[model samples]
Target chain A: MNGIGAAMRDAAEGVDVRAGFTGDVLRGGRRRQVRRRNGIALALAAVVGVLGFGAGMAMRDVPPVSDERLLAATKGDLADDREVLLTATVAWRAELTPSWTRDRGVTELRGEPHVYWASTTPVGDAAVVMQEGKVREQWRTLVGLVARDPADGFPKVVGTTNPEDPTAGTESFQFGPGDRTFLVVDPGIPVYASPNATRNPAGVVRRTWHEVPVVDGVGVWTAPDGVAPSTVRLVTSIGPPISDIPAERLLTTRPASAYLRSGVHAKRNGAPAYDTRMWNNTSRKQLRVGPDGPAPSPDSDLFQALEDAHMTDIGPPGNTGTWCVYGTSGTGGGLLVGEYADGDEPSTLFALLFRADGTLDRVQRGPAVDFGSPLPVRVRLPDGQGWVVASSQYLGIAYRTSDPGDWQEAQTGSQAALLPDAAVQVRVGSGTGEVVVDLPR
Target chain B: MAVHAAEEDFEEFVVLRSQSLLRTAFLLCGGDRGAAEDLLQEVLERMFVRWRRIKGPPEPYARAALANASANRWRRRSRKPEADWELAGTPSVCGHEEQVVDQDAVLRALAELPPKMRAVLVLRYFDDLTELQTAAALGCGVGTVKSQTSRGLARMRELVVEVTR
Candidate 1:
């Protein structure tokens, strides 16, 4: 025939689909799901069973820490590195004085600490140990991380799951300042590593989310060399995401500054042109960077194009920002994504398509980012080349420096980069704290 | 998510995409519809088990898993070896329409190749995936995909010519 494609299509279409095929697939899938859920449950039970046995024996002989303290500490992702005999420090007093004792106005860390989930990290022995402490009079939980001081090799408390408040809402403790880091979350929280800041409304940004896999009550991640700690967000259902795991210190090794700031300005005839659209403030409100490439757009220019491409509903005026054309060789043109400076003011992010002759082809704009919302503003480039990533600040992407590759600056106002399919570790971020995260294969 | 919602999503995905995936499986198996249905079911079931944990849409993961699983299956069954077409014999193509004859002969040619080579062709040409997408689906290098597509087409041409003779 016509070609192998046509032949294959003809042959496949001719293959009759059996009745109840979808039902069969669903039933089989449900069976497999039940089996797996049972598997995780069984695995958790086994670990807890052994722990309970150990605690029982310990209670009968000496009772190092109370049964309540022991059980409380052992909760959350019950995976153990390896069962080890607890080398309980003699006597219940402070080994080196936990720093939290002297400062708090209300509750102090009381009762002896119990080292529960101790495992060898990429660095040294790290543990998700706990000690009983009262907060404001209520016996609240205090979670802490134990790791070698890295400075002198002395095992010290690096960080703790922070709620220290009357109530705990998915608190997290991330250990870092090295090549690899460990993290622990208080079970019920759904966590993702995301970009730092996205400008709102007039200059919105598309934030990214890569699920943080928690093992043994710790988030398993390693910041590649020469990068900063990735921002982690606790995605809540109804509202904006709670930005957790602040970029204080993590294996990313060094701290990066938030250098994203630019108002809607573009290059026109070798000079600057600004998006004098709704709530235009890029002129006085930009940080150090922002909507700087493709100047202000004609709304109707991007309207029909965006609709035809099934990108966005580009009606009258809502979102306004600068747009640029990149990857000219691709059909129609490259991705048209825009972002804003890291300011909370009402700014919008827009994506535009244009011809080589500076003619407008398509336009897309929206609320940009709903921080607490799970919806992602996405644009799949034509012909499966790649997609776009937008944020408030400039971004540089590359395979890990720890592995091999240099950071390439993302496209101008698009604030986006098209990651090639072969990359392993793509480092995408800027002053908003660069995170060298794994590109899930 | 609650158990019911997860089930709903898994069911939705299966009903929506299983037909298309079944067709892909059919081509990968050299037009064995029964084998294709079974292969698709196995992959969909596996995806169901991981429905909640899978972020975004499950199509990408499903395709990749299908390609990889299909290769593994062929590898496992290859130890015993299946009967091959008799290269020395030529069946008559006279009565059948030219298009029908070509379709049957090309499918037979596909069945003659190694499973991975067959999978590479199906993903690249039939599925209309880019070289990179094909490579990713099969967890192989783009170089491997390129070479496999070339060799598969050449071998199919030879087989089709011999069969028509």
Candidate 2:
């Protein structure tokens, strides 16, 4: 095999030798003119630096202002500690459920507001709910039912599809932040305040004002201690608040300055904006502030797909900056995969590989997924091609594939689609298949 | 002021990097060497104009310029016809090996790759770029570079099997 590889390399080397022949012809004409011009430019730069230094000495400098005077001029009356509801843009919003820790008599139930973004698009009003640190379970927004059938090795929390009565059985479901996480809230009844009190349809979600007086579609809440208001941050495609949020307590978090400068695109509805690659700038402080890592182990196939495509970045030029890598093992067809970059850890973005005949074959991930053990959450591409899941906690790979009803688990120990034989099947047909569309993943 | 470099040095750079550039051009053109060469030359010429902007080792900048140009060209060509008849005259392998079989099959396989996947393979395996280097060339996150590379490699494997078999 090595000999065969070397032969291929040798064959390729021959092509290089051949290209060398014509390359000289292409360069012969352009070289002379460039040399003469460069010779003159270097001399000019030296003279300009000498002149500029002389000119600088002739300028006057003003004295710096004193700190005391600056403080005196900017003094105000009182400190404002008002808590405002942080309405994360669609990009950073997630339904977080607190973990249930058993104790003596009183069960300390903490509802965490999981706020990681997903590359996968929701079908018929689906919302991903986070419970355990790495467990990204999908919840139908209205009824809060897991979408995956229990028979499948991994059952996902899917949204309801009842158009007529989306909220038929969800009247008693509490809609406040945290199932054990900290969220900012006012000390009031987390009651339903929609114009119509009637139960919403299965998939429809009607916002209920947890706090009474609604000021600008937001209300103050003294969140559960675990779900602190300060921890309740929002993620934007543009990243951090360019300006301050309307509330005083909610200071706009700054993402890695390098990330902002690097120019990752902020995606809206999974579409890249005009001059950006993928929107993934999260503040390092925010990522560090959270007790858990990324809630949903994003689909590994998506990551693998991206990696195989040469979309993964190695560390900075000389390891001078942070380097994050993610990967995936298998995939289904329906995914809206792109790229994202928070200043902290790097996310592994993945996309599916299509056969020459347009059939979905595999998914790719960069080095990101290998960093964690395995993730419990699995992803179903928008096309319903296959399913990919991962979990560092699992003894082996933690995902299953197939249509909604019947899914098969991936082999243990293999968490990435490193070879050709590792392709997983995504059964797309009548039942759950019709719901998934063949969109870009 | 206009910029220039010694003829010898310029030739050296071109000789050293031309094959890599050609491979990238190949992928960008859906495996058309002639079109890729044309694209590579256009970039090299532009680099000649602003060679001063490339202060450090010129290879990275040249690669960036070529990648950018290739991507732009791919986007532009996609809007036009499938391929130009003139482009058909371009050669696939520079060598004339009587033993080489299924040359057309290789071309067909190259054409089958997705635009992004094809670009990565061209930059990585064909152009001999490291993962990070490819990512920088593509202006995407490292994660994206990994995913795209995996996808490209997988597709290439399957296509190779299909074509060779």
Candidate 3:
């Protein structure tokens, strides 16, 4: 033990001292060159989009939704049959290739199409889409649907009715015309309207996105009085307890390809859903799901499970590692979801899996789910073969080995229905776990 | 005046942190010279445009950018399993000849730690940063730094014990 500690210390010290000089020298020189290139590029873009600078600056102050409003929106009730359309011209850096200067386009909502949607209140299966208009770069001539099941907070690509080829070579999300339908059953924070503008220290016109810290209250919807609409006004002066105070928060404004290449949207059921072939960043390696496997499909239950969650996890993926896997049942019903986590580590992934549900049936270490954060964390699964999750959040693929480990004394109900097509064999660090599902292959 | 103006320029910040940033990269890459170099380049390019105001210290920003980039790489690689890696050697055991131990194991253990824990450990052990410095680098209180460091070290030790045994 003593020798071990000393060795560890020596290793750490050696790493520290060696990394210091080498990392600096190598990193400094290479980074300087890259930064220089980028600096020149940004300077050129600024010159070209000079007109955009002021408007872009003007758009900056568009108020953000408050926490109270977020909470209130969560609690808003729409009758079982009520649904309404939510539309907004979101302005962010396009998450697509060539990274548009900035996005200033309208996204519209109607109840999940093909479903009888009533009021605009957001609910479990509600769907909204960004309509076709001129984006800064390639034109999206038709309506493009980005559907979300707030119930699970997973989002899927419904379809691109728009003409111009917008996002290709990107990790495309498929939402069948009706496959990704959502029901907006509740009222959310009314769209916030900007109050006024302020001048900058440079005497340039500037505005900040501010929201009033008021409790639940609905402001009149003015933009589309002709259409069913909802809108509200918020001020940032009220401060705390009433609303989410405005602070500089990082809103992702990168191109969609950049985001996709990061694999932030990859992985499910603890198994690698997408293959590295999908990775656009040739400089970096794509996350290995299970050995050479088929690509993800629109019919994929893994994709379905992700769509169930709005495509946004509770927190950043770096915080909690998600454990997932596909499993089969004797009755032919398959399970999609397993234990899910919000932290970015293997233990957190395992802890979330074994949290009394036994839904994460396997005891074997599963493949690592690397959330884009500091350091890659291996998402581990419990040992066992053919583990199934009742929910998609816990789906993970363990390395190959199908022995059912000791079953804990826990709730056993109608075993989870598994999807057959999704059942797969996954390997991790030389170990294998069998993912048995009932979905058709 | 040029210095002040340059300080405000995003490019200058990237240049300033390049070396330290690379060092951070080297630590995260488990001393894999090639991967570390590649990771450093990717981050530097990312910080190139936004060099002006990445908010926190350039080092932390760089570290974070590297971490996120690496994590993304792993996520994609895990899904595809296509990156070809030559076997450096056999897995190293604890108390075994120093030459035989797996450097990847130590790295894997470190990588397995929570992002925060791993970050704290890297700052402390790899970078040899003091507790206060680590806290400052991460934008947290000293307590968080201390607790995270202790947990990370313990986790690393556990991995070592499990593998060596």
Candidate 4:
């Protein structure tokens, strides 16, 4: 045994146990069984009553569910049935979560839920059912549907729970096998799908967000078979694409192709501005590959400092011990790097400027997720490389930095950028007006 | 018939793994037998309820639940004063007297770490869980398990020094 193992073994030695402990455990098992059975029985009874209510008034004409109500519903429909809507309401108010919300118990819902909208897509006869329930204290208005296969009469549940963030009025959820998905957004939230969103010469992944109208916050459209939710965006229907929060919350802002070719969104304090996804998908939709520094090769020493720092687990999975080099260093000899880290020690964003010899030439740890501070952190990289700017808030879009120019999207997710050197500092425009990520001299 | 069969299997699993789990639980609670017993019994009882639904090996599930519950239940009140890891430095356990001293120091030091950090170390070292396995047991990512292990060992050594000093 190695030192820790042997030491642990010795430390864990000589524990005493009572003879009747096993028997006590067995008894506890019976109590648990009763609790579980009672809980299930109660749940079943409530669901059965709701089902009966939906079926009983199957013929009653009902008005449309409020646009707000749709955001908190559990299932969706292609066509709205008034009875179904009422039944869903009863269940939501009573907090009786049906099988729709519990596992993929779509087949277990007694019958099809309130059909709000129905469509014949390549996927099949997709009926968006508005299944509403208060699951586990959160109002999970799932954007789900019952798709009756044309070949078989069986109905399958598609989509998932509503956004956990109550303020997140729009979210994409996949319930179909693979990545086939549906979306739930606030009513009239303009949505789009880029069958093929491509990056333009400007170095931003531009998507012609073809507007797909959302009725009561649910939109389902036809694609070949498997449509990736990443291709979806909720933006303005007009000419200029607007900064859409729902699009930002698409669980993806834009495709990963948006590389900031100019400045590093760096902070001397190691604050990271590494969000490639959010920066690309918005109306401000593009970041120019600025005229500065040598273009980063994949073999660049951006992560040399990360290696020096021994950050074994680099990023959210696929992001470790690799070069995600963003911008060119203005000094030309040095490579500026930004890496994200979160630990019990310190949740920080690192701005590492690696020397030609792969030493951490200059490093600053950025401030971590600050709920009170809403401004996006953008600061000049060492030696006047492109500035590094990123918003680390999880929910809201930091569209406008402190400076009121083109808004820098506040992103809770991760991004990596290398910017062009045309600008002195990134004028971050957010609701709070222009907040400058100070150029640390 | 199936219910009783499952019940029998559950009882057997508890009987076989109780002592080992209790030891893990003991270490997780920073060597508090009373707390370890309570944590194990609670976890096993939950296991007894969830035994049938738990696929494959039930030991992993029990261990996972124990680890998760141990981590979750770790609150500010239960925390020990921070160990001065830098001051403690690396422990050199070579001579018999030194080895005995190190061993005793290690136990005391282990008790002072945050419960989640200590649990990671215990699961990694004592239970011989791989990094991935430890992550699964703790309901965390493998990266977390790795970092926790590195930090835990470094902290443990520091505390070991502190104890011996």
Better of 2 and 3 by TM-score: 2
Model 1: which docking level applies?
Answer: incorrect
Candidate 3 residue lDDT tens string, A1-441: 223333334333322223443335333543454445445645654574665553122222322322222112222222122122221111111111111112323222211122112123222332223322334444332223233433344333232232222222111122222222111111233223332223233212233443322122322112112311111112223222122323222111111222223323323111222332121222222122222223222123332233232321221222221233333332223222222332222322221222223232222223333333221233322232233323222223232223343212111221122212223332222124323322111
Can you give the lDDT of residue A54 in candidate 2? Answer: 40
- DockQ, candidate 2, comes to 0.04
Cα lDDT of model 1 by residue, B18-123, tens digit? 7788778877766565667788889888877777788866887787777788778888888764324442112222345776666667767777778899888888
Interface RMSD, all candidates in order, equals 11.3, 18.7, 12.1, 8.8
Question: Please, what is the whole-model Cα lDDT of each candidate in the order they appear?
Answer: 0.50, 0.36, 0.35, 0.50
Best candidate, lDDT? 1
**A1-441 in candidate 2: lDDT tens per residue?**
112223233333333434354444444334433344444534544565667754123223322322122112111111110010012111111211111111011122122222121111121111222222211222222212221222332222322112123222121111122211111112123321221111132111122223223222122223345432222232211222322222222212111121122311211111112322222221210111111222222333443343333332221111111212223323412222333332223433444444434345544432332232223123333343343333222322322232343343334343221212223432122343221212113
lDDT of 4 by residue, A1-441 (tens): 147788766655666566999979876765566556556745765786777754233334443343344333333442344333333333222222222133322221221234455544445455454544344553344544344323334343433333343322334433233333444343444555544344333222344545555654456543335544334334434443533222233422211111011111111111123433221222321222223544444344434444444432211111222223344455554444334432112233456564545444655544442323433344455444655554443223333323445645433233323443334343344455544443333
Give me the candidate number with maximum TM-score. Answer: 1
Q: Per-model TM-score of chain A alone?
A: 0.36, 0.20, 0.20, 0.36
Which runs of model 1 end up more than 4 angstroms from their true locations?
A53-441, B82-96
How well does each candidate superpose onto the true structure, as a TM-score?
Answer: 0.35, 0.28, 0.26, 0.33
A1-441 in candidate 1: lDDT tens per residue?
A: 238888777666645557898768765664565456546645655776767764333332323333354564453332343232132121112222232332232244445456656666666566666655555665555555655555556454555443332212233444445423535442545445443334344333344455667665556555446533433222322223333223221112111111001101111011112333233322322212123343333223443344344332111122434433244424434344543322223334445655656566555454444232211223333344444443333244444323566654544333335544344455545565666554433
| Per-model tally of clashing residue pairs | 23, 111, 131, 69
TM-score of 3: 0.26
